[model samples]
Target: MNPIKLNLTGSPREIGIQHGRALYEQIRSQISIYESMFQYTSKISWSDVRDIAKEFKSPLQSLVPHIYSEMEGIAEGAELDIFDIVALNCRSEIALGRFSDGCTALSWKKSNNARVLSQNWDWTATVKNNLAMVSIEQIGKPTIYMVTEAGIVGKIGFNSAGVGTCLNAIRAKPMISSKLPIHVALRLCLESTSVGSAVKTLESLGGVASAQHILVSDSTQSLGLELSPVGNKYLTEDASGLIAHSNHFIENHYVEEPPWLSGSPIRLDRIRYLAHELIANGVSGDTITPGLLRERIFSDTYNAPQAICCKEDESRHISTRSSSLFNIVMNLNSEAPSAEVVFGRVGSGEEGPVLKMPWV
Candidate 1:
């Protein structure tokens, strides 16, 4: 694969906006909206909205006119305002589209998350400035093209202050399209300075969204948070150390699909096998490391739930569609109490130092 490598280092808010500008442009050419978007979805608590707005800072806001314009264009279909658009930029709100796309986050041990396997996936540019990376998959939607917001981040790479977030694909239609999409909300989680802040940002938002995600961070914590705008519910699974997540829901009352799922039972087993292998082999923050996540995510052979290759048998009329491996990984290998996002891709070259986030 002709993988793209990226290295960007600067202030936190600017880094966030810089990453997103391209996505705004791409969405513009693809989906033409007729009105302005919201700064926050209607159901989101006012408090959460306020905190995220603070994070955007003035400099970040300066670069948002393009996004605001896009919001105006898609407003007829989504019904959002420019303020909601700004809030989405700050990671305060999330847009849950039709069809349940999801995300999951879990913490493996620092020792386990630290491991680094040699990456041959050709992602040299991605490691730098990527303090975080994301794998984007659209099970039944066209809106989720590349993972970064063109780099804006509705969804983003894990590894922020020891917290990692991942999104999933599902099926569901919204009563009202979000002012902010799910990917943007998760990206906001990465921009948080602390795990507590990340948790607060993720759970408080309200909207209809499909999919599952496992958030892992600081090598000691992990969480599986689920959001369903249809059910108007959000749930989280906690762990003291190691954790795993699949495509379906693991909750009781809101169980629609299992987070531990995929296109087939075999796919489910495949992820389990890999998860077990990594953890058993001491996949700690000091061992397994973030680079491995990229390698595994793009692997044509063992990436599990293969992209869309034809199976070996004739009766298998299976559609080998690509799910979540559509985006990049953000490996946040921090060097101090303050985060210095050492970004890189999972499948890229040997993990190396790239951008040192100016926020540090």
Candidate 2:
């Protein structure tokens, strides 16, 4: 174990400020790089950004500038042009915003009937900016957040509440007035009191405008909820039993993939194989360990593709703005959900808590 580093028990507001400071003091340069990149990568309007930001409880929005600066430094170090930066950001949003239709959910009860074992995942992108390796040991626990310039963004974490939330993204048509940035909405959902509330947060409050989400909450009872938001359309599949997910849309009509980026399809294929392999290898619902979870996401397939690469068309490449450090996982028990931040190697070198805010 990493000896349970970082303090996780705090209100959403407190963690949001911590995220701001982490970015300002540790990753300001990288955040700046991303700010410029986001202009083109994200189709959202400045009005939308401001509007979505308005939903935040003042303290979180105050850190946006600080986070932007940190991203800029990462861009400068990598020599990314404006388009390259935007494309990279867009690619990452696709990775973080979308949800896999295959994931299963768990429902909590008043019994210790189920337990978490471990988590292992191996993440790879077409660019160095998105390369990562991580593993989690032990059962479902809490993953806390740290204040980066971007407020309290929960990169990864498990909770005593038996909830495990991972974020990914996919592309869609340009969002106008109705579309909201996913990060803002996710922050709100993370702060929510329960999964039901989290779903409401995304729907009633800070709408993703255009995005996909995979929410996994295990209350000792398996229940998986996959939410997809693209424009005015909303779709979800409740497979709250035994299942897994990857980077692909589920519904046929609503499978809104932009085709601007590639590789996720292949990743999904690998996910299928890995899921079966784990199950066959004696991994069960309650016994899934963090180390196993990491492998499921990041393990290298003998003939599978590598994550980072320098491409001729920079738009196709991933960057730190896309991903620099793979945030480690935090396990959660039966408690209120909080942000379990996984620090990236490139950004802050260590993660601040990713707060689960209360908008959902």
lDDT of 1 by residue, 268-296 (tens): 34544565667677665545444465344
Candidate 2 lDDT over 310-357, as tens digits, reads 112234323222322333333444654332333332122243333232
List where candidate 2 sits over 4 angstroms from the true fold.
1-19, 39-155, 158-160, 174-180, 220-242, 285-287, 295-297, 302-324, 327-332, 335-360
Steric overlap count per candidate: 106, 127
Which ten residues in a row are the worst by lDDT in model 2?
99-108
Error at 226, model 1, angstroms: 1.7
Stretches off by above 4 angstroms in model 1 are: 1-25, 28-107, 112-147, 158-160, 172-180, 205-216, 230-240, 255-265, 281-285, 290-320, 323-360
